[model samples]
Target: MRVTEDGRGLQGSVAPTPPLQAVVWATGYGPAFDWIQVPVFDAAGEPRHQRGLTEAPGLAFLGLPWLHTRSSALMGGAGPDARYVVEALLKRT
Candidate 1:
């Protein structure tokens, strides 16, 4: 897959958005604590997780809200987010 960004959002045109085999809206049923409009996601546009940790065993989130700090969910705070993920993984065993 060819991927490039021009810094103005998407630089070049992309092929038509393909249809999904099965669209599973990952929008979690809202967070237990509401904070914003629309489903709040981490900087990766993925679902938010607590400390990047999931309830499922061996499963974890990488970048998510409140993983380490108030701003960790934003783009520049991935460091703490990553650390949290590692911790969660280690505890899974």
Candidate 2:
């Protein structure tokens, strides 16, 4: 498949293909987060964080894989990271 230069449509070659009623494109690119309207992420569009803690006060993330451990994205891994974030929040309070 080829993305349109305007980044709005796709083109592909498929034999005996029916007219597309709808198309859903899934790109593995990083999150846009453009709708966030916050100064949390860096220039790269990734949340500026250290172990799920962002520079913005009272802002934190969870369930990010490898945040602090290999399992950080898993339910079990979320516990430790949650504790850490909570601890930091408490300190600020």
**What does candidate 2's lDDT look like per residue over 1-93, in tens digits?**
533344344444552223432221111223345544447777777777787776655556776657789987776777788888778766754
Error of model 2, residue 44, in angstroms: 3.1
Query: For candidate 2, which ten residues in a row score worst on lDDT?
Result: 20-29
Clashing pairs in model 1? Answer: none
The parts of candidate 2 lying over 4 Å away from their true place are 1-32
Q: Given candidate 2, what's the lDDT at residue 45? A: 72
Work out how many backbone clashes candidate 1 has: 0
Model 2: which residue pairs collide?
A: none
Candidate 1 lDDT tens digits, 30-79: 33322222333557555555565544334444434565687665656766
Model 1 spans with C-alpha error above 4 angstroms: 1-49
